[model samples]
Target: MVVVVGKEEVVVVNFGNSKAVLCRGGLAVPLSSDLKGERADEKGRCDDEAVVGRTINWNACHLPPLSTTSRSLGGEYRKQYIIMEPEVTVMKRTEQSDDFLIIATNSLWNVVGDKTACEVVKRYCVNGESGRLMSSDGSSTAAAASEAATALAVLAMAKGSRHNISIIVVQLK
Candidate 1:
């Protein structure tokens, strides 16, 4: 989730593996972290809980066999292990330097790095004088964002990502 604070800062909140990335001056900045059971902190949290038959890692290749993500929206039975909490980040926006924001699922991030994803989006969403994506054909920011999202999804697939991919590109500049 995203909230713009007074037109100067953006508040990003995320749970699970989904992530948020901000592009500033052509640089990629991460706004969230992937919450998985294999993570030390996450594993400790589960280990600390006083629950009987708590399984942290299972025989399967996927760590946190109960769920891939340590946090999520719903899982009544798995509530003992999974959480609904989120990580929040507030970043001041640079009107002249900040370019755009990308929110995508783990599928894209599993195969793509933050810098590469930002570069791919920036390549498609070049801004104009109006600070919105514009082309000689009068393409709008929305169209450019869609194109960027599509490009990222395609890249993830080409990189051998088998999971479902979802991406949202928002022009900030």
Candidate 2:
């Protein structure tokens, strides 16, 4: 997650199973949260073999259950196990040449890792393109990032990925 707050814009990105709150003036302002478990699989089931008696290794690195509302919204009946606390990156420019960019994704980390994502962002930055922009208010930065991530996912899909893909992108100026 990268958050950039420049003289002209503010950007934010979310990619983990945790919640991220970007507050203003010391107030708690939630920038992004895994309220819907959108990153989780729709058909993935909890690994029953992972459970030892009644204790389950919920922290296991394995894929979570499709119905598991461990970290999402609209699961009032189930206990909140986790929150979408996104890894945040903030860049605030004090000069007039301030700009913001963000990218996000939900595909397998093995396909397009964070280093690749950062490289993509850097490439976009050096390429000098204007269409790929981040949000100014920092509200849509994640969305912008998601778009970039989606594009990467599509590329990965072309390469071959037998799974669903979702991404968000946001840019500000």
Candidate 3:
């Protein structure tokens, strides 16, 4: 994860299934791509039909169930099964655009899509939730970040994610 608050733009680099997005106003400008690991490409486009056919053939002869492996960035069997690559993006940052940066693993994304996550982060920003994250006990920034992260995890679990969930919410001005 990388965010440089430059005078002109925001630079972002994300790896694997985790993502980093720039939310401007109520919209989102995604900075990373989800790597499902199994497929030859992300976005599930048919342009890669030829590639998909060959992958399926290879998997049939080697691994089965190519549906889930379409895009992943995990480590296990990455060389043989999935693609673990990172997506880097750069964008201009303005008062009206590039509001927040959302960096989290698939654990949170698998449960809630971009829109939902952006909304949650937006609310936190608008309501001064970051300031409240530390609470009255003189907790540190880590504590506040942890509190928001646990909230996201709990939400994901409630949304029916079977995997372990973790999140980091950064309130950027």
Best lDDT among the predictions, by candidate number? 1
TM-score of structure candidate 3: 0.63
Residue-pair clash count for candidate 2: 37
- Give the winner by TM-score: 1
- Candidate 3, 1-173: lDDT as tens digits: 55565768777666555777667766877777665543344534312434444334442222224434443444564444434444667877775445556778777887788888776655444345332334225555445555556666777888987564657765555
Q: Give the runs in model 3 whose Cα sits over 4 Å from its true position.
A: 1-7, 37-77, 126-146
Residue 103 in candidate 1, Cα distance off native in Å? 0.1
- Candidate 3 clashing pairs, residues 3+ apart or interchain: 35-71, 35-72, 36-71, 36-72, 37-71, 37-72, 37-82, 38-69, 39-69, 39-70
- How many Å off is the CA of 75 in candidate 1? 2.5
For candidate 3, the lDDT comes to 0.58
Give TM per candidate: 0.84, 0.41, 0.63
Residue-wise lDDT of candidate 2 within 64-128, one digit each (tens)? Answer: 33333333343444323334444444534333332332233334333555445445543333233
The alpha-carbon deviation from the true structure for residue 79 of candidate 1, after best TM-score superposition, in angstroms, is 0.7
Cα-based lDDT at residue 111, candidate 1: 90
Clashes counted in candidate 3 amount to 10
Candidates 1 and 2 compared: the better one by lDDT is 1
